[model samples]
Target: MSIICKYTIFYLSKPLNITTSSEAMLNQVRSVHNVRPPRMKYPLWYLQRERAKDDQQLTEDNRAFVKEAVHDKFGMPAVIHGISTYDVRSALREKSVEYENVEWSPKFQRTGLIARKLGNYPMWLNNGKSVLTTLLHVIDNHVIKYIPPGEFDPPRKPYSCPNHKKNLGCLLVGAESADPQYFTKQYCGLFYKEGMMPKKHLGRFLISPEAALQPGTPLMASHFNPGDFIDVRGKTIDRGFQGVMKRHGFHGMPATHGVTKSHRRGGNVGHGGEKGRIFPGTKMPGHMGNRYRIHKGAEILRINHKFNIIWIKGVASPGETNSIVYLYDTLLPLRKYKSSPPFPTSKVVEDDQLIDSYSEKMYKFTNQTITYEEEK
Candidate 1:
């Protein structure tokens, strides 16, 4: 299918003003606001200014900003690996996330913290308070060095994740917003000694840099392609312990027709008198959530080629807004790309015409709800 645009939504930001004395035309001339772009004008602001009479159009800077965004062979919002550490202390305090650059290829997913699932309660809102994270331009993140799998002696200090080779891979990230003075020499020394840019946040991708990218390569939205099926795994919001009625979806006791205090309770949880101690795994309230969970097989919707921003399929993704999400190609057969993915690592390409030509279907959203209209 071809790319389709032009969906209009009205926003009530302020009162609109109309001039009675101003002369008007009979035929619609696609009048636009002089103060804002057509995409942001009436929906975000109150009044739409008349199209400028100067006829001076915006240069590349004004018409629409263009940045070469990443498109990929994978689905949208590519599966990014997430970390689960109760240790809030392990953070750089500035709050950052990580990733690795695939070689400048038209075959990779875009970058950043991606998206985190909030909950299963649905994210759409009438007040506009619940939109997913939007893309923000950050400085091109640089790779420090290719931390080979095996052990090696550095001229200065040892590297991060020194013990396990399998656990560590390539590190890719953006500019440092953290305080340099707060860091240790061992951390600081690792980068300066190797002639790599020091990073505030460090993330390791599963594969080799040579396969996906190179040392010192800059990762961008253009790194990832659209129409990907990503597997998002993250620590769900902790809800504490809950009962089987709530957690396991058990049918509780009858609430009517002579039912008394037993209502809403799991009646007869035990078997006989001798074996009366509530059996193991009996539906009872304990801990609810905050566990590591994965929402698999979500489709990538629209991608802003300029911002590397992605709109995924469902709102049921894993973490909260602004939370960090690791992205990569899916491992599951059902969700994996039907076409062969670029193996080993991706190659850097300048034109990205290959990306424009690849066959991909963006995700779609519908006004339908999940309902089981069946009775047992």
Candidate 2:
């Protein structure tokens, strides 16, 4: 009787060649409980995974010829010069020019600058306290293009601004001019309209339409003043696949007491009974760093106009030495500048004499020695 029962169950489990109404009904019922896979957030072309470095396979002579041709086409890289100081003063005097017409309000947002992290050093304060600062060099930056609010289209998935009515324009800024021969034609075309050389780094800044800058306008370290708080955005150093002990700072098992090979393992991932699955974001060991992080409210301790370098407070800024970082105004309400800062951008004269600007609290070596007086 047991054998007969087993044979009957096996026969029912096997798929039959003939399609029956009952089987069709069973399939339809199963389909109703099936969960669909998540859809892609961005378009296919948005991936842009193609290698940026192109191998042209050109000979040494061919490369030299290409370089010479590019040099002749766009002479030696133009010196980044700002609007004449006279013109800037005239605009302020007249009070009728465009610069005066569009005053920087609290609601207004301006463009950002691109800078390279050039390591860090310590600075002394007037109170005899030491503060570590990171040196950021702002290379030759230029305004590439400006897209108006209505025409500017960004990715829809990661919507930063909650308000739908706020129309923020987009400003394309490029830095570190490079030879055109190294970049592809499509990349070079971006700078062709402005008659500028191709840039190594490109950044997009969202700003109010009123702060729109003309293409080819130069951006320098003077865009930000000393003592103003700003935000630094950069990619963190890439520390590939790491263990939980280092990555998540997990406390491993005791070295003694006969602990086996599971010292660094994240034991007991899921509960045994009802809640059988592991929860998401469980801080398990995986690929770490190489993420876009923003270090906010870093005060500008010093500014060097001669070399276009900015000394920002703190050595904890994201990224390793010599990595690219983006600088913009801080969003922190308390740290936000009460007065307007270089609306559109700062303009300087060719014969400008300002070399270094330092914060009041900072102790400059050039100043006289401090003297302590006895109380009267």
Candidate 3:
């Protein structure tokens, strides 16, 4: 890696202007761009400017005021519990289409749920193979509101297409229930109409019109079945102000014989002349991670109904432990389901009694040790 970087620097140092160039060999002399420190010809969103001096002071003062007020008046709101008037089971029964009648077409898209990442654990398969799996718990998820396709308007942004057509509605999903007394009146008002407690984390999922769920509808772990493939979306861990070596995996200048002071530097960005300015997408030292990303086609290994936890087949599922994530059906070409999924989400039957569900290859904790048949 170091050798490759050295060769690149050597190549970039060659003078683009051959006629006015020095007579001395190009390799012997270092170009000004090669020896000098790299500077940003362009700045990204976060690094454009510095905040005002009073901004930090104002934020700290506001935080203190809120803290003191809560202590003096509310004294930490208690966990309010109550039943919702909207009967979910009865509402489903009244629908014109029966459970079997509502078919899952290949074109149909499903709604997603917000889950909290609960770290990871190791599991052994029946074939003596061990696999690492991440635990994502669905934490008191409920549909707050649904905006139909005609009413939905995509956010106006430079990256977004201004003329893009809207074919799906948006479902406001929230997780990790919280009390309303601590929040502002405007914030609490959003949940008041839905008859729900304030949620710690809320996310919006764009789902087709046919998959639109009613407000106050509860979502559970069974929304996905064992062996199903899901897409996990979350913000990756924030790595602030990193160097080229750590951020871009670039091999720095060697740290020995004749090398001095330029050990960790990213040498040379350009050659002098027509193509003079540093390229826009050149990898350099800057902010790293903390971006929203989706890990597609992660297999669901197992699920526990009592705890509302699911074991998915990847340790690299984004987000730190206890952080919120959005789980949805995979839109990948080959991984998409051939048969029907849990259409319109799974129903909670009062008489049904299954504590745990596992995929065929998974080894259950409650089961006996594995034994293979003797060779013939």
Candidate 4:
């Protein structure tokens, strides 16, 4: 008896399909109903036939059975019957999880359980617009290491830490150049095994073990799809301490002929006569900036699936130019998100020869138009 299951990282209320032009059949799928998250190569579907079932055997009558029996239990798709028992550890490893900063929210650890754990966040359009224009860095990032789950080695979390493994989750990869001395011999060997050059940054994504990929995988912008909700995590610009006037925006003493010295100075801080004490949280700024931040629920404008790059909403992505940032699917609910985004995920077939071809006309900031159309 075959089965199907779909354990979505997001809520995904609408029906889903993944059809692409590369496939002779429906390999990738898109829809008018809703815009889904970017399509990363997740090893979520692994089907190894017990006795090599043929294509004709998987008929409509059989699809219904597969849905009710397998998909119902495992949350996999209907047509994944004759596939191999692929590993999911690598998918989780490939993911570079973006977490909400600790200062902004105390439930930092809780977020780990919140994303793909609680429910999927919905995708939404910004300012009632259907499409958006954003930035994407199409770097040649490669998967240097594939640490399968259950077989994960050291560097495990101290129990004080939430998700910590030797390799943590699964595939660890990132942009160009990694400093070899900073890593151990064993760790460096993993990258070599994949025949990948050292990466500048490496992160492990937590994907379903059943749908993981092998080591030495070349990753690019094509990993993500257009119109998905991804949370951006990065370091905010650092601003040193300042007085209440600068930090809290307190209107300091006016600069007048007589009040020259008091200008920009915080007025009498303590209530000398009554309280004789400085209250807590008294907007007296000491240090500022240089904190980790997350721009939650940012909408993806477009995804160059061939490039493994995505363009997201808002220019508030933390850090200055070239600072490393982590982007992940938003871990929020549908009702709480902005409206007008695609309800379900999308997929489309591509050139059979180019499974990882880059998009020529990618979504650019110049392409984004404002709501200033002249009525004819």
On TM-score, the leading prediction is 2
Q: Where does model 1 exceed 4 Å of error?
A: 1-145, 152-177, 182-200, 208-212, 260-264, 267-270, 273-283, 338-376
Judged by lDDT relative to the true structure, which candidate is superior, 3 or 4? Answer: 3
Estimate, for each residue in 1-376, the C-alpha lDDT of model 1 and write its tens digit: 1111111112221233332212132133466534333342221112222233454455876433321111111112222212221111111212122334334343333322333332232233322234342222222244444544342222222344435435334444434323223445566555444444334555545453334334445444344445566666556666667766877777877879988877656567787779968888777767877676766766554444333344555666555555555555665677766664443333334543332221143212343543345787
- TM-score for each of the candidates: 0.48, 0.77, 0.71, 0.47
Against the hidden true structure, what lDDT does model 3 obtain? 0.73
C-alpha RMSD between model 1 and the true structure: 27.6
Tens-digit lDDT track for model 4 on 131-188?
A: 3334545444445444555665434345454455333345455444433334445555
**Per-residue error at 177 for model 4, in Å?**
4.6
Model 1, position 11, has a per-residue lDDT of 23
Select the stronger candidate by lDDT from 2 and 4: 2
1-376, model 2: which lDDT tens digit per residue?
A: 6564444444643564333544554455545444445555542113232237867899999988886777677664445432111111011122211333487888888899998899999988887788999999887778877777776765552344545534887788888777766666767877776666777888889888888877777888989999999999999999999999889898888877999998987666777677888888788889999999999999999998887899999987899999999999999999998999988789854546777889999988787776667899
Stretches off by above 4 angstroms in model 3 are 1-101, 157-165, 372-374
Candidate achieving the largest lDDT: 2
TM-score order, best first, reads 2, 3, 1, 4
Compared with the true structure, model 2 gives a TM-score of: 0.77
Task: Give the Cα error of residue 80 in candidate 1, in Å.
Answer: 21
Cα lDDT, all candidates: 0.42, 0.77, 0.73, 0.46
